[model samples]
Target: MDCGIILPSVSPNSNYFSVHASPRSPCIMVRCQQKEGQVKNNHHYNELPLLKRKRPTMINIPVDRSLENNNIMNTSRVRVQEVEVEEDGYGVYSKKGISRTRLEDRYSANFASDAHGKSKQALFGIFDGHGGAKAAEFAAAKLGNIILDYLRRGDKSMIEENIKNGYLAADEEFLKGNATGGVCCVTALVQHGSLIVSNVGDCRAVISKAGVAEPLTNDHNPSREDEKLRIESKGGYVDCCNGVWRIQGSLAVSRAIGDQHLKQWVTAEPDTQILTIKPDFQFLILASDGLWNKVSNQEAVDVIQPFFTAGSNKPELKNACRKLVELSISRGSNDDTSVMVVQLDKFAH
Candidate 1:
């Protein structure tokens, strides 16, 4: 993908500032102040007055007219630098499905400052598209923003409200499409010293805390008594197939993003939970059923923890994600595969 950076234009009558991003480039901004004095050359120059030997005060003045018109007088420059990494440092890859017409998986991560100076918020997500890739893409692009917006708007005190609003917004966007609807989503927002997780459908989020793997969110499916009751109360019947409950012999999950026909019975809202972040919070793995089907949560955590303990960074996390997808394909998981991994320490400043 081609990426571009945008900068705002500078004003002529005010102090100008500009920021540029690149491996070796320095971010800088220049400020020019007005100059006053007589000058022989067109180029602006400052003059220093002589002082008395005993005690005196000195003054400086500009000597050029053109420099004043061009706003080059008494110019001051500031440079801000950012850490640079190699292109391969991100470590991401994709593969084609055996029978699927198109790739239906997506993953993304973002890092920014959190409440603590040495801590940062790391966002990781996995979107599994069912009927089409539109809903998945829509959720990948907009859900993060909606959640961040809610947090920035002072709604962090209510985690459930923030997650529900974000999921609903993404669902509204997907409804504009004409294709069948189905998307399983899982997200993790790592803040100061906590991990806030939310999920819909079977896509899972598991964390390795103190070498013990634990689920952060409940999976919404018709197999559960509560889920079955909720669906049946809406005049929807659950068909048991292979020990799993299916909605009207169609979907396996009772909750998801799209699936408009089953919207009345299922909900787009996800179950949200917040956990205290501890030193033992080693890593987090988020993946669709393609990977979860072949590997259990604890197994998934076990397979990736070695690399993380060996000092793997963002690149390692990306590699872990791709490896899960590959494992799914090798294990005869014909479904489209999506996987994402997030390392807490890598995000900390």
Candidate 2:
């Protein structure tokens, strides 16, 4: 990662400010465990009837540049495509927020099982940085590749364990740096028809299955009952300030990638969920808190559903992704916003 700080350098007369963030400015740390001893059953996902497979090939989605002429796409910042990773099974899109906050969000997606000479597998992740972009940036640049390399080593049974180790590796690597900041993250890994979703902090992953919306991860906010219990059990305290629940009246989340100062409280652990990819699964959504803070899960599904059903390609999907981010800004999200849309079963039928 480059050590140079990327500050806003847009021309004064320009209407837009170029946006940039990378592992260049993020932090890393992790501590995960599966909560057990709970007998209560959570409501199951809404399943949809499978329709006949009769659609044409889905279009190739690309980065949406509709805002290029807007006040946020100035020449001072490198284009989003410079960091986007798109291919056959997935597409990722990210942009700077309308806020003056550093462009501290980062994302990654990879779907090349052949490269590893194994059964098909895909990995996707999104990180939202705070303090600096170091944690998010570091995870974005290294996490998925680490998992992929681990898988290539022919040890696939302990998927959750392997992923946790990967997060730990990222955390250890980031702690070695001099940067001071942290990042929240969410990841979706699909292999052998199984989908595993893992997350820390508020960034989220939602899936649209047969027109119904299903959230894959929970936000680790300080106020969440379970999160609060976990923090207090660890000898930490939570407080409410100005309508927001914060850890020790400072951080808003209970878990994150990096925060050396709060390492004892703000854990790096991620909650994990596993499920088989059903035929009804339509698309998967991953995004930073900026978009979720302004949009509801159902609302997002409603806005992006039509595009998927219409056999949308790369550019169309890119537009859909861009539309969601723009919507967040319009809805008053002053934080950096990033979104990724992965059309499941895109190669099917």
Candidate 3:
């Protein structure tokens, strides 16, 4: 069985050259198999001339490693869904897990520059969906823009309020769609040397300060005392199911953007904070529970430190993000993993 771009099988008798098939973009895999009689009757191979080589030869072909790496990262059970890199600052990587038959993780990364081409602001988000991918996909595509629009209308002092409003606004829009399921979210906004971080679910943001890991947002799980109290106060219940605590015996997260049935208890109001970007800040990591459940915050920072700490204007952040997700998968996480890495120094100015 072969997988790649949709193409008809080549006739061995007519084709004098080799045809190499590779996936250029996200594509479907189709298996083309010949029947026993077809293979037995085909004499095309015998008609082709063969030349013996004394040794091996290196073929000089320009290759796009981004595409190649994406393919190489996929396994029979796991699929690499997305790989995006902005050499100027950040990169993102997401993969479907072995336990899940589909990918339910989505992400967004946007950077704004000033008239002089200087980096002025950056936005990063990770959305992890449960029940379905619709909520995550909707939030990933629409939340950043809504938040940035709010930020444009306010000053740094109002960053917190703007971010919160953005989350609520996006939630309202999504709820109007009558979508089922919900998405855990984490967003990082950088502007005027201040890093604003926000979250409403298990998605997390962590920053590396001179090689030390500092969490920017806490997971809003039903297991938390505050979260549990909030849910119960709203006439909801929290129960432990199979060793995992869940709200109302349904969702594991206490807050999110959708899940209309649980909207009253599972609010979309994000906890927001602002931190001044300093020289000590190395980089920031935004990821879903897929990575956090398996990899510790310090472990994640340590694994990617060498890449950012290297004195290079263009660090290999793409590879760094890829390695982090791979590490999580290796650690027995059977959930979709998404990771985004941003070099702090790039936006420090």
TM-scores of the candidates in the order shown = 0.68, 0.73, 0.76
Candidate 3 or 1, higher lDDT: 3
Give each model's whole-structure lDDT.
0.64, 0.72, 0.79
The per-prediction CA RMSD against the true structure, in angstroms, equals 19.8, 22.4, 9.7
Give the alpha carbon lDDT tens digit for every residue of 82-121 in model 2: 1243455555566666553446787776556466565376
| Residue 179 accuracy (lDDT) in model 2 | 65
Winner by TM-score between candidate 2 and candidate 1? 2
Residue 301 CA displacement from its true place in model 2, Å: 0.7
Put down candidate 3 lDDT per residue, 68-185, tens digits, no spaces: 1121121223333554454567777777777876677877766678999876887878888888788887887789989999888867567889899899999999999998999999
Positional deviation of residue 222's Cα in model 3 after best superposition, in angstroms? 0.5
Query: lDDT: which is higher, 1 or 2?
Result: 2
- lDDT score for residue 263 of model 3: 93
Candidate 2 — what's its lDDT?
0.72
Q: Clashes in each model (backbone N, CA, C under 3 Å)?
A: 1, 24, 0
